[model samples]
Target: MQRKAPARGFEQAEFQARTQKAQALMAQQGLEGLLLMTEPDVRYFSGFHTLFWQSPTRPWFLFIPASGKPVAVIPEIGAALMRQTWIEDIRSWSAPAPQDDGISLLHELLAPLARRGARLGILKGHETSLRMPLGDWERLVRALPGLQLTDATGLIQGLRMVKSAAEIEKLAHICTIGSATFDQVPKQISQGMPLEEVFRAFRREALAQGADDTPYLVGGAGPGGYADVISPPSRRPLQAGDILMLDTGATWDGYFCDFDRNFAIETADDAARRAYDVLWRATEAGLAAAQPGNSCQDLFQAMQGVIAELDDQSGDIGRLGHGLGMQLTEQPSHADFDCTRLQEGMVLTLEPSLGYGDGLIMVHEENIVIRADGAELLTRRAPPELPVI
Candidate 1:
C-alpha cells in the first residue's frame, strides 16, 4: 500500500487544543505551571523543531500555565524559530551564561508563584529526566525554594499517550516509508556482505524512501539465530544458516516508526524456522488481541501465551512493546506491571520475542494504531515464513 506524505508541521489549532487540554489537566491537579526542559515535551506544545537539541551547550524551556498559551524560555539563537510557532511569549537569553544560564529568567517567571506557595510540576517519575546541567538545576532550585516542586510524570505522559488525528497521519506516513525501505533489504544485500555495510545500506534506502532520518538502526547476524536483539552491527560477513535482523526507528518530520524484520541468509536451520513461526503466530495473536477495550497487560498476555508454547521466558527485554510517537518509545508499556488500558487513537508496537537453541533469540515487531474496533497496522506485516536471501 502506498501513502503520500502528510503536510509537515501542524496547524495552529493543533497546538492550541493541546495546550488547552494540558491546562485543563494542570488546573485539576492544582498545578500553577508546568515546566518542560526536554525536547519532545517542548516540541509537543510549541512546534519549535530543530536539531540544535543535539548540542548540550545550551538548554531550552517551556512553561505551560493553567489558563493560556505556553511560554518559551529559550536561548537567543532559537528565538527566530520559536517565533514561528503558535507560542506568544518567547523569552530569550544569552545561553551558556556561566553567571546566569537562564536561571535568572526562570526565577523571575516562577518567583511570583514562590511568594504564594503555589505548586509547580516538572517530570520527575520513571522514563523522565532533566535535560539541563545538574549545577544549573541546583541553582534554579535554590533560587526558587518557596515553590512547591512536584512530580508530573503521570500528568504529562497521560496527555501524550493518545495520538491525535494529525499525529496519527504523520506516524502512518513514516511507518509507510520504513516498510518500503525494509522491503528492499533482499535486493540490497546477501551472503558475503559485511554487516556494517548492511546497516549503511539500510540508512541510505530509508532516506531514499522519504525518511528524514534513521537515527536508530541496530541488529545482529549469526548462525541459526542472533545472540541478542540490541547488538550493534559487526564487520562480520553474512553466511548461510545466519539469521539477520534489522530493527529500525525511522523518522519523518518529528514522528518515529519503530519495527524490525528478519531474513535468513541463504537458508535457515530447523530451530530458527520454528522460532520464527512461534514469533509470527505470537504477533498474529497480538494483532487480534489489540483492541480498544484490551489493557496493555491483556495485550501482553495474549502474545505471551503464544510465545510460552515454545519458550516460557520471553527475552531479557523487560516489556513486550510500548507506546510510540515523538520519541522511539513512550508510556503505557505492554507488560505485566503496566495495566494502562488501551483506548481509541493510541499507537503502539507489538513486539514478541522468544529464546531458542542454546541462548539464541528471535524478536518480531510491527507498528499499529488502536482504532475504535481493532488494531490497524501502520507498517507492512512481515511474511508468515522467514525469507531466504
Candidate 2:
C-alpha cells in the first residue's frame, strides 16, 4: 500500500532550532561564525532547497553569525527562492563571475570577524569539501588576512547525526515507500531479463510507490553470488542458478531510505543459502548491539562475531554500515576504528557480507534507528532464508 508523504520541507522553527544548536556548539568551540558552501550544509540551516545546485556554474554560500538567522550569499538567480526561506539577509551576485563570484559579499559579511582575528569554522575533514573553485578560495583567504578558518566537521556533523521528531517522520515515510517498492521485485523480474532492465524496473517501481526519487540503485547477480556491491548493471541476462541483490537509496521529501533485498532467480546452492543465513543472523546481532550506550566499535564487533563463523576475513568490504540521513551515507561508520557512540534518534544501517566458495560473496542490509530502548527497524526485514522466484 502507498503511504502518505510527509509534509514538504521543514518549518521555520525547525531551521531556527538547528541554527541555535550549531551556534551553541560554535560558542563552545570559540568559533565566531560558520562558513558553509556545500548544498547539504546550506539547506540544513537555511531550508534553501533547489536543484539549481546541480550546475557548478554558480557557487552558493551560507554564513551563520554569532547571532540571528543565517545569511545567504549566492547567485542572483536564487535570490527570490532564498527570500522564501527563513533567511532574511540574502545577498546576490551575477555569475559565471569568476571575476568576483560573491567574494566581495563574503568579505563584507565576515570582515568584522577578520579584523579581530576571530576564529571561523568551515568543513575541512573527511567526507566534506569546499564546493568552490580553488583559485577563488585562495582569493578569499588573501582578502581576509586575520580570519582563522578552523575545521567544523565535528561540530556540524555532530548536530546532524541525531534526528529530531520532525526529521524522523520524513525518514520513516521514505523507508516505507522504499520497502513497498522492494516488495514488488518478485513480480517484476524474470530469468531472461537483462540486468539493466531490472535496474530500470526498480526505478520505475520506486517512483510509482511514492518515492520522490530513486537516486541510488546498485547490486549484482551471478551463478551463486555477485562479484562486488557497487558495480553498475551490465547487459548480462539472469540465469536459473543466479543469486541477485538490489540495494536502493530512495528519497521522500529530502530524506532517504537505504536498504537492499536479495532474491534467488530460480534455485540456490547450499553454500549460497548458508551465507544468507549467516548474514541474516549477523544483522540480528547488530540490531541487539545498537543501543544508546554502545559505540560504533561495539556494533562492529557484534556483527563481525557472527560473520566470522563463515568468512574470518569478513570479505574485505571494509566498514559494515554507516549513519544515514540527508546524504545516502553519513559519518559514524560501523567499524572498529570508529568509536562514535550511538545516541537516541541516530539512524544507521546494519550491513553484513561474507565470502564463500571460490571468491563468491553475499551481502545483506537493513535500516534502523538507535533508540533508548534499543534499535528500531526502519525497513521491512528480508526473509530469513533467500526467496526463490
* Alpha-carbon RMSD, each predicted model: 1.2, 1.0
Q: Which stretches of candidate 2 lie over 4 Å from their true place?
A: 312-314
lDDT of 2 by residue, 225-300 (tens): 8878887999999999999999999988778888988899999999899999999999999999999989999999
lDDT (Cα atoms) of all candidates against the true structure: 0.92, 0.91
Against the hidden reference, what TM-scores do the models get? 0.98, 0.98
Compute the lDDT of residue 5 as modeled in candidate 1.
79
Best by lDDT: 1
- Candidate 2 to truth, TM: 0.98
